[model samples]
Target: MSHGYPKEGFNLVGSWDDWKSFVPLSRSGQSGSFVARVPIRRPPGLEEFQILQGQDWAARYYPTARGEGVEGPGNAHGRNFRVTPLPSDCMQLEILWDVLGRKVTWKFLNAAEQEIQAGEKKVAAKKGAKARSAPRNQASNRGPFFLVGSWDNWKGFAEFLPFGDSFRTKVKVGLDMKRVEFQVVVARDWNRRFHPTSSGDGLAGPDVGHGLNWRAEVGGKKWLEVTWSPDRAPYVEWTFPDPADAHEAAAEDFAAMLRDLAKEGSGAWFRGMAGIFEALPKCQRSSPYGAKAENEATARCLLATFLRDLETMADPRGPAPGGQRGALKELEEQCEQLLKDTVGEIDYATAGGDFMQEALPVDPATGPVQLKLWHRLVYLPLVMYVRNTVHLYEMLERLKAQSSGAGRGRLRALLDAKGTARESPYSWLVFSIVGALQILYHARAAAEKRGGCDAFPLELLASSPPQTVWIQDGVEWSPSHGSGAGAFQRKQVVNCEPMKPLGTLRKGDGLMYRGIWLPADADEDTIRYQYSFQSFSRSIEGVMRVLRFYSGVASTKAGEAARAGHILMYIGVKFQGWRLAMASWQ
Candidate 1:
């Protein structure tokens, strides 16, 4: 696998593009055109040959095309090729390349990160995998959540759901999903056009120029001709060996059936709920007979209607309820109409309206976090995901402080002496940086690997979301600033909540330790107002990021053992509490 980035040590050209090719030019004793003929140990063939400046390529005729073109004995090693360089202003390049000389072999490894991920998913699906499920910090509960394979056995698409959600997601059953698998390997940038007659000397015969790309057998047969490129990006180019439109129409029909089945399921659930409402055992026992009977009758009717719809839709592949196939068109129109009417009747509040006002004023804490500004400045910065990246450096710093004699021994603070400086743990994230480095080093062996840049775009956001909530009207939600007419008295923050006070999120200033800074006369209704990013956890997070990037250690990256070490060393140092070093950047 290749390493990521164009940095020294691991990079081929280390820190820059555009290599300087050194060529020694020799002038013949008598020259008409002053030709600078660069001697060739072996012909560069078409791939490495390019006509730049005043240069040209042609056949240096061979008599028998064997043993330097000599017909007689001692001629098994036949013809040789040379690059013709002429006099002109353009830069002329000539080269005799081999594994040794100025040539650095570069090999590009496969770039698909999905391979390892798929493997992990399969491992997680095992009957008894040792993976532990971590608790989620999510606040809301409703979800289209299902776990396939991830942290805490999390899997599937979970973008809408934050990392803070639950410890685990429900298991959605269907399709025997765990068993479905597909693997593809694409050998990109390899020479697809090389003749078997050219190469010799235990090297690839001319056709060997393409070299060993890679192979993936799908369905137990070799999948061939899959393509990849510098211009188009590598991808599995399997030509759907099955056939064009093979079962596509049937697949679409099946999908439609599945959708109908889901709707039926929902209908069944609602109908059953109606039955429960109609037969409220408590109501039947406590309420009058007439009222009980009336409620029961209404519930039964609702339940019956639902059951009828359910029965009609059973075996989703069947016809419509009214025996009118293709009634979906009319039903869609009716549904659209109902949506429009319902929307028309709805009265959503406009921005800056009176309801937007907070119902109760924030009780001025004898502490901080009273105003919206405070929440934004102090609290919002606190909830940072302590990852081993440049993203959360500053917040990590704050987490270390927030007490008397703070900043003594947070893991990062201690690591400042031991940790690296100003670079991501690219070496630590092996899967992320491995392929590019391999390409950087092995470019010569494989004809397809030459002359390409290694830098790639980052996969995740530069930073995490805000931790503390920022608001002006606390008791109720509002859009307007404070002091509005007919507006209810409210503090910026209804509450001064704390996630982890001393854990991080502090101004580099010991002054913030002035503790909330509420006025002497400040009461429950007093609004707390903070004013600077210096007070934010974001700043601390920033510092931590720089530290992580610099360290580049693999084992110590955001792992639990690593985290415990950080906290132990940090709190132990600062608070003089306890000292324990769990993990190091290995």
Candidate 2:
């Protein structure tokens, strides 16, 4: 609902506050509506509150005369709006303000579970049926049922306590959990597991048919109730917090991660980037066209901006007085040197060697042959690339003690060669870089600005030939890219082209590549950098190709047979391997 007529905002003053220290409501991203989720910490009972404009009792909101039992003059001193308690931890307070008459209207809603049930009711009504509740029957399990899911890394078996005709267990979810998938197993047996019958909610029955994993949106919930009995549907009662609150919770968790990293050993790198990290997750916004493309472009530019900024901050010649070396100068130099050593002096023209030369024949008339840096980068052994990257991170940690600006803020390397500790598929370098870029991108979006120049504040660094640099469309040659010398200036990248959908599938598809003009401000002509943006696009295209293959060659019955045959063949291979291994042991 609304706030102070047309002036600033308003707060919800109630019995909980003793009519003092009013709770302010935030704008709900709507025109004239404001909302707040007021926590009910005490006993559930009648809650009395009134809309107080700017925390002033002189301009309080009361029940409208149109409301039943609302009597007398609906003025500042009128009766307070009343609400009976419902089964909820918090109450949703919505206020609508009308500037014309300085009128105020509000309503209370049971926040979490009730909101979900209300939606369920609407869905059931549309299907011309009444909403159904989980059936309760007294039945004993053959053995103890164990809970296994993401909450416990799918390894530990948390046994359920016996309940009336069913086994029930309390799942305490982590604060960072966005979604959770789980299953109940009897006697800790994987084969005797329960799954969702249809692909929606969970069902428990004899393992005779295929089923999907039982899943639910945790949405920042701290606890869940999972109940199941034999020959019945398994039920998981999930407590989903308010969506806005959930978003805030997730953002706080991500910020905590960044703060922890800052405290570890790369303090200089994260020095003035705290505010940016805190605002990154909130940068997501809905657009007319889906947000996927927007997210991708933002992600790409963000990565570019982060790498550029890191290079600038770690430059040997710092912007600080006396031309002092940067705090990360040593780390930067070591990493750059390591990269150069690993890849060697890359000559893009001759990097591809015989294979690339034969693939793309160059005419003698066309001066210098153009080549893609991407090809060279990808062609290099992935193991070598990752190994070198890991080495760079290790060097950063080792040199942190001698580094200046701030210490104990080093980003940890995720790729641990010694498998003593757990590690993620993505390395810590990727995480740190991605986090920094997100901050810059969101900060730029909030400022309502476009273009790489505005999005990234750091002066574009200078790059010599034989070094790889990404250039987007709409680039124009300028005297200098940044303030420094030997820098080639070019027009800033504002927008990226939307990703196109894969057309009709073919038996085989090659790399769909394109050529880009590499800016050379000094010379009138610029060499083209050939690359493929469709590398990632091929994954989805491959899936579509398989689907089209089946659709073209087989009928529904035959398609099902083919799928079954594939599964049987896969199982047979596994069995054969097991037999061979056993024979080898003998």
Candidate 1 at residue 36, lDDT? 24
Candidate 2: C-alpha RMSD to true structure equals 26.1
**Local distance difference test values of all predictions, in order:** 0.22, 0.36
Winning model by TM-score: 2
Shift in Å, residue 238, candidate 1:
19
Best by lDDT: 2
Question: Per-residue alpha-carbon lDDT of model 1 for 1-586, expressed as tens digits?
Answer: 1121111111010001011121212222432111121111111111122111111113111124432321211222223332222111111122212211212111111111011111121111101111122112211112112112221132222111111111111112222232222111111112211111122211111122333222223442211112111111111122212212323432343344334333433233223223223333322222112111222222222222222222233324433322222232232233334434422221213222221112222223312112222121112122212222222332232222211111212222221211212112111112112222333223222322342221111101112212222222344423222223332332222212222222132212221111122222222222222211222122335445433432332211122123232221111122123232222121
The positional error of residue 545 in candidate 1, measured at the CA in angstroms, is 14
Cα TM-score per model: 0.14, 0.25
Per-candidate clashes, comma-separated: 67, 18
Residue-level lDDT of model 2, residues 1-586, one tens digit each, is: 3342436476776654345445556566655566553433223445677776676667666766565432322245647776564322223434454433444555544422133221221101001111123534322234446777877677756555434334445555666988887776755556556555553532444342234456777776665556554424335443433334433443454355456654544333222223222222222110101111122222223333333433333433422211112313432343344435443444433322333323332222323234332222221112112221222222222222111111122112212111111121122333354443444344435333544322222211111111113322334321122122223222223222221222212112323221111111211111111111111112334434433333222112223233433211101112112221101000
For residue 46, model 2's alpha carbon misses the true position, in angstroms, by 5.0
Where in model 1 is the C-alpha error above 4 Å? 1-475, 478-488, 492-586
